[model samples]
Target: MRLEFVENGPIRLEGGRFRVRVGEREEVLEKPRLSLCRCGASANKPFCDGTHKRIGFQAPGGVLEVEGD
Candidate 1:
């Protein structure tokens, strides 16, 4: 599998099968691609519902620098 973080947006995942687990619910995805939320503004929890664009979220793509790192 491959993951690409979009600039100032959701995380893009594409490739083979993968699993998504939330609480007691687990699901296996066979789709070619998926979008995951990073802005914490998605009404749909782990999935991307384009709320980041609506909320004007800002984040850097590629390598992320942690404050204490």
Candidate 2:
């Protein structure tokens, strides 16, 4: 299982449990791949629900590269 932050998209969760909490509400998803909406415009809440595409949710606005040995 891995979690990856894309350049111009939501947080990608793969092969693991995806969980989120906001205020008194919490959500846990057990999908293979999911894009979490960070733009806070998703009607589906914890899930991306294609809101990022509608509102044009940009990434962190930087270049990030990770290398492992």
Candidate 3:
């Protein structure tokens, strides 16, 4: 799967299997596409849940840490 860092937003996951792990919890995703939370404002924790849009989340320009790197 390839992760594209979208401008001023979350990381977009395109096509692949993913194991989303946060502490002791883990979620397996086999979807073709998905958006991950980066603003740390989602009520859904690791998942996007679309809270970023409402909060007007703007990503600062810098190096982005790759997920599952």
Ranking by TM-score: 1, 3, 2
Best by TM-score: 1
For 3-47, candidate 2 gives per-residue lDDT tens digits of 677665677767657676888988887777877677889887667
RMSD to native for every prediction? 5.8, 4.2, 3.8
lDDT-wise, the better of 2 and 3 is: 3
* C-alpha lDDT of all candidate models, in order: 0.85, 0.70, 0.75
Predictions ranked by lDDT, top down? 1, 3, 2
Best by lDDT: 1
Per-residue alpha-carbon lDDT of candidate 1 for residues 19-53, written as tens digits (9 for 90 to 100): 99999999998889889999999999899999999
| TM-score against truth, every candidate | 0.82, 0.58, 0.68
Those runs of model 3 whose alpha carbons end farther than 4 Å from true positions after fitting are 60-69
Q: Candidate 2: what lDDT?
A: 0.70
| Candidate 1 error regions (>4 Å) | 63-69
Candidate 3 local lDDT, 1-69, one digit each (tens): 567666667777786778888998888989887887888898876668887778898875333445674
Better of 1 and 2 by TM-score: 1
